[model samples]
Target: MTATVTAPADRLLYKPEDAAEVLSIGRSFVYELMAAGELEYVELSRRCRRIRRTALEQYVAKLSPQSH
Candidate 1:
């Protein structure tokens, strides 16, 4: 039998790539945000990390509007 994966809408955690997709930004920028502590993530292990959906929302909520 094959295993089933969680749908995007039902997911609480997201990989960096997934976060990038949701944010419409590049994956590298997601990593930069994580490195800079702008975005929060859960550390499952030394090599495993996942970003929470709330964290993404908070990040967006905190963005200042740009002046043009």
Candidate 2:
């Protein structure tokens, strides 16, 4: 038997590393994007940060040719 996983409807939370993996870019680039305000993030604590999955999807959508 195989198990299937599904994402939540809201999908508004992601770890920095997970976000980086989803974008297929370096973690450093994720920081750069966050610093540049290209990606929105939430600071959970002094040493923790998270990105919004919906925001990431929106960002990608904006980059699509049809969106431009």
TM-score of each: 0.85, 0.71
List residue ranges in candidate 2 displaced over 4 A. Answer: 1-11, 64-68
Residues 1-68, candidate 2, lDDT per residue (tens digit)? 22222336666688878888777778999899889998889999998899887777766656634343
Task: Please provide, for model 1 over 1-68, each residue's C-alpha lDDT reduced to its tens digit, 9 standing for 90 to 100.
Answer: 22223337678999999988888889999999999999999999999999998888888878877789
- For every model shown, the clashing-pair count is 0, 0
The candidate maximizing lDDT is 1
- lDDT (0 to 1) per candidate: 0.86, 0.75
TM-score computed on alpha carbons, candidate 1: 0.85
Candidate topping TM-score: 1
Q: What are the RMSDs of all candidates, in order? A: 8.9, 7.2
Displacement of residue 49 (Cα, Å) in model 1 is: 0.5
